[model samples]
Target: MAGDVRAASMTARAFVEDYLLWTRGQRAPSRIAGASGDVRRELVALRLRPSRGTRRGRPQITELRTDLTSPTAGRATARVIDRVLGAQYTLRLDLARGTDGWEVTDVSA
Candidate 1:
């Protein structure tokens, strides 16, 4: 069960990474245009496509801390510092144990 939770956390993290990459113009145009306001803003500012030759990947998730706000409510907030492109940012997640997986209801950076 713990492993499942961690895996879900990691998957959610990956989804965020994809969204960021799409925003930064590193991905295709269609994908880029799909981002919401927050993702688009980061993408425009991150300018990742210009710095794509760096060693580390984009928006690396460097730190993550979890808080169980209630017995059935949990959250994880992360600090993603992009060494090559993006500004120092924080990713917050309002997590809950769901029937299928950990559902991230809120995400912001």
Candidate 2:
């Protein structure tokens, strides 16, 4: 049970990291799940498409903390520092377990 919680936490953390990277144009959008339409549109609107010789390095996940309230629901917070942009950002995530696994139900920064 403890291990399951840990795995869910890790999964949520990785999901947030990958989603952020996608928003910043450093990652592709193939593997992510449970993203809202508005979020995707916003990312697309940013026009931050990655290109060769881009100025910013990939963003790094600094600190990720997860709270598993139950087997079905949890929350997480993460700190990401963008080396290229020279900025630090926080991500707050809400997760819910499903038949497939953990899914991000909501996220904010």
Candidate 3:
């Protein structure tokens, strides 16, 4: 169970990192490979798409934390604190265990 939680945490962290990069145009959407359709839609709804004209630089991930209320429940939440252009933002991501691994199901800021 500990290992499962750790894996889920890692997955959540990686997803956040990749998603931030994608937002900055530093990475492609494919970088967020394990995200669910709902997660993608949430990004669109949040207007967190990549920059269009000038490519933005990478954001720094200052803090990342994951919470698994129930290891066996196959669901987890990740909170990420990132710094971009000297401003900080908090993002919350919900994840669920899938057949291929953990997939991000939702996102909010």
Span of ten consecutive residues with least summed lDDT in model 3: 72-81
Clashes of each: 0, 0, 0
In model 2, which runs have C-alpha deviations exceeding 4 angstroms? 33-55
lDDT of 2 by residue, 1-109 (tens): 7876787777777788678667656675554555444455555566676665343567778898888888788888989888666789999988777787777777788
The prediction achieving the highest lDDT against the true structure is 2
Ranking of predictions according to TM-score: 2, 3, 1
lDDT of 2 at 41: 59
Name the candidate, 2 or 3, with the larger TM-score value: 2
lDDT of 2: 0.73
Total clashing pairs in model 3: 0
lDDT of model 3 at residue 51?
50
Pairs that collide in candidate 3 are none
TM-score of 3: 0.72
Candidate 3's C-alpha runs over 4 A off are: 41-54, 72-84
Error at 50, model 2, angstroms: 7.0
Select the stronger candidate by TM-score from 1 and 3: 3
User: How do all the candidates rank in terms of lDDT, highest first?
Assistant: 2, 3, 1
Question: C-alpha displacement of 8 in model 2, angstroms?
Answer: 1.3
